[model samples]
Target: MGKIVFKRLVEVQILHDYFLTMGDGISFFQRNKKEKEELLTQRINRGLYSAGSIFKISPITANKLRDNKILFAETSSGFILGVEVDEVIEAGELRFKPVHDISKKLDLSFSLTTKLPFFKSFTNLELEKSLPSINYFTNKKATLLNENTVPAYTSMPLTKTAPAHQAGETYEMGTILDFGGTIREANQRTDGNDPAHWEDIDDRRFVTRADKVLLPHNFKIKFKDYQLVTQLEVSLEDTGNNKIKKIVKNSAEPFKDISLNFSKIDENDKDSPNIPSGIYYLNLKINGATEIVYSILLDNDLYDYQNFGVVELGFEEVNSPYSLLDTQGFLKTKIEAGGQKVSHPIFEIRLKNRRSYWRYKKNTDFTPSEIAATSNHLEVAASNILVAKKPKALTETLLPFKNGTNLLLPTPKVAGIRVENEKIYSDIHINQSNGLLKI
Candidate 1:
């Protein structure tokens, strides 16, 4: 019975759509009673959309409805709704709230207030009533504040000793002090130790007092390439008497070492008198140009080694030639003995003995003994060794000098021609099998 009822309902909905599609206007009105009531409410709401009306409610009545879900009101009421007679009367008594009182709330002193006039409406007041004028000048005069004034004196008297002036004490004009034999004028309140407040009368005396005296000592200056320098001159001057003393003047071959000999008047003159002890200015000149000037004090009581010692100076030349030859492999070089028949010329070969995975077979022909007797005799031989099985990179090499002074020539770079079948070859050739081989 339930199924039959549902089937009839479905059939009715189908027929309703069919009639509407067939241009039948009566089918829409034939809808269920509930749907017809919803259509009527929608038409009434459309009329109310464009209409508005005023509402009048008391504050107590609005407050009661504030909690209502459907028709609720906020705590803040409109001016016409919540206004009371007492509140209106109290607002009139104050007229305006003083903005100056806000300083107390902000935790500031009341004396620091801007002192602005309170706000007031001019409508209720009489037209002839005058308003309070604002005074912009609020600072008090220095005289009324009991502040010190500038003195009329031209100069202050000089003090023989350092003044013990306090930190905040004020002084009149012409206040001076002889602080540690230095005349300094007090430009402001000073602690007497600060140099900024004092004006220096003699700058030279201050410099002399601050100058450091040195003992008599030997000086030596070295040049990287002394051959390029055409002339070198050094002099000593007595600072007190301005007496100049010639130290060294070299116009010929410039020596590598420039040293001062205090025992003699000059570097080469041993018979001359020794230099006296005093403060002297040492001046170094290169190519007739002043290179440097140094003040030195010589004390006779101190020994030569006890005083300030040798000072080594060097000039950097970008174009100077390097003393060592940096290269890889063997090098063959000759040394000219100036056509003098030389016998048994010393030859040395240096190589780093690094560990290898496999031992390399040494070639006997390139040994130092065999190569020393070759037609192209080697005066000095140095090179990196590279085997066919083992390869290595070239590292920096330092040439050993004879007697720690005479520098030897650097080793030359050499490349191997070929090596195969337990034999070393100096040239390349094509073997019988048409394969490249060393011979």
Candidate 2:
């Protein structure tokens, strides 16, 4: 019952990749359109908000802490809290040596401290609060933490996909497993026989902007067959032939999960058609369970929709209600320039968190209080993805779009996120067309 050690990249050095397809995502969304649409309603709503293909990374060489291996100072994008440093410096070539305001707030102006010829130093691992939580660079520590280890879900493809500046931003499906969910394979029976148990989500990711949404309803599933969670269905993935055609049966949930107080997304359905952000997936069959598929990014970043618009901060799925403003369970808020085209994509989704709670440390049979009383229960058990909408105005072109609505956007009424701290704090809803949205 003991073998969880994971965290490895061994080497690093990539130095370039800043792609952004579709004529630069359509000239960065027609010069950040959304000044309230209108270019004749964006040429009569074409492709709702087209633009795809994304990449953004720049690392030349890093990782070299020798010993057993563990050097991560300026390159380790998200979630790898192997924490426990004592010597691993390079903070990008040292240079902050200013001291004097009673010291503690961080000081280093660097006139020439220690060894600053080309940079290289070690011994400072108390990680001042894991160095500002994340977006790492280890504070720019440069690199060092080598002990070489891996096995606990070692998918390190860059922490299992979605970085490189999110390869061009656009996501939404939120059942909480980030990198847009859907990477299962280790669950040899929830832990008994030791299979590195994995599966967890709190569901609540909002880059917000509504054209009518309300059908997802908080489904924190763990699956062992809670009625297959009502045979759950949601479908919307055709990602150019990835296949997943139909079955969104109007906000599904009926096969049976005994309605653990279900809500199907805060009341919405006014003629549906306003789901045009991007990235969505969630489908489950329910037999012996584990069919899995979950992802959601929905950034209403219509090219910076408007002043750092969809700036979400903290809370990705645990007891949602915004994870109680995340005292520290994962709190982030980014979007540097204007809401979607910003430099902070919520720190690219809080730098892709996973530092700890590696889904209850990849459960080997549960015992950290029964895997924290059942891996944070986020029961969705079954669902689907994607929904695009367009042609709902300019006097309608030919309504009836449904089998997966095309012409470029036509899929509203998907509302499925909740983070209650009560008196409902925070607000932001802008639908533009379609309708209904009560979050």
Candidate 3:
């Protein structure tokens, strides 16, 4: 009887394909029929698919279904009835792991190959926002973690320092020691004899007021994405620090080992949408000592425009035989920021004539070549001489001094003045800033 009923339900395939497929078909007929519908209703309710439905089947029934000896068919009332089956299989035999199965099944369709590039790793924010920071070891004892932070704390002890502005200057925190000495003219010279003299231009001396001296607040910055091309412009003057100053004193010792660290204080800015963006704290350290520390709110618009000055290479036509003592040449280049024109200083170069070499008037066509030759000779001569005795007793800038006052070649060292053949090159002395030689 069950087999006959199931066979009859199977014949309703036409209805199942057309209308019975709409949603839960059994529920639709329940409203139309007020009285109980007997076996049809019970089967319909029991056949609903649910997570728990699999457990309701008896072991015998499950085995019969699995073996295809008995099956179910749909009726016009959206109900299932016992029916015969033609296929038999365990469910586990057909099941598969989703990820593995999809790849294996579609490998041919997807064209599996190792040529595809794999993503290496996410962008590093810390490296991108890297900036210089003042680092130092503790000189005193520490009780806490006793490691990294302790050394830093002791070196940059949180002592209050007099404001640089107290003397009408913006001072960094902790920089309490004020070198009250007036800005004396720094002597720039070198001796050719000593290898150390080549870097003598950087040596400098300053007297500071002990009472007013204090540690400057440290400043540092870390670029979240790009590198910050840092240039230090320190002004010991009252007008404020120069952002671009080429002269690094103390054999470049004063400018060495300067560190700055920057931290994002504002995380809400769209431009700096990450951790630190709009505002940040800057930590600056010099020679393992904290110089200044302060918070700075950055304006993206600040660098929108660049302030620049044009450097023009000034040249004058002169007779080839004439001694070109130290003719200054000039070229125009621009440096700008924030759409404003910046005041550019003067440009100059110092060169000494090596010898009087005559050029044929017919060969005037080689003007560029002649200019290059003349430039090279003057450079070689200027580099070989010792210091200018008139300028200073020490050889700040060694020049190629001639034996006689005639400025001739084969010149010996002026006894009182210590001069050597340093072999300075013109290209090495060419200053990019303001486009001129200071001497």
Highest TM-score model number: 1
TM-score of 1: 0.20
Point out the worst 10-residue segment of candidate 3 by lDDT: 104-113
**Which regions of candidate 3 are displaced past 4 Å?**
1-181, 188-263, 266-283, 290-297, 304-384, 389-439
Q: How well does candidate 3 score on lDDT at residue 317?
A: 21
Q: What C-alpha lDDT values do all the predictions have?
A: 0.27, 0.22, 0.21
- The sequence of per-residue lDDT tens digits that candidate 2 reaches over residues 1-439 is 6433322212221111111112122211122223212432453255332111111221222221222232333332221212122221233221111111111221111010111111110110111110011111112111111112222111111111321112211222111223244332211112121213333422222111111111222233332322334444444453343533334322254342322112222225555444444445544444334543444333322122111112121112233222211223221222223334211111122111111101111112223442222222211111211111110110113222222322222222112112222111111122434221111
Number of the top-ranking candidate, with lDDT as the measure: 1
Judge candidate 2 at residue 214 and give its lDDT: 18
RMSD (Cα, Å) of candidate 3? 38.2
lDDT of 1 by residue, 14-47 (tens): 0111111111222223334354336434533644
Model 2 lDDT at residue 216? 26
State how far residue 83 of model 1 sits from its true place (Å). Answer: 97
Give candidate 1's error at residue 32 in angstroms. 99
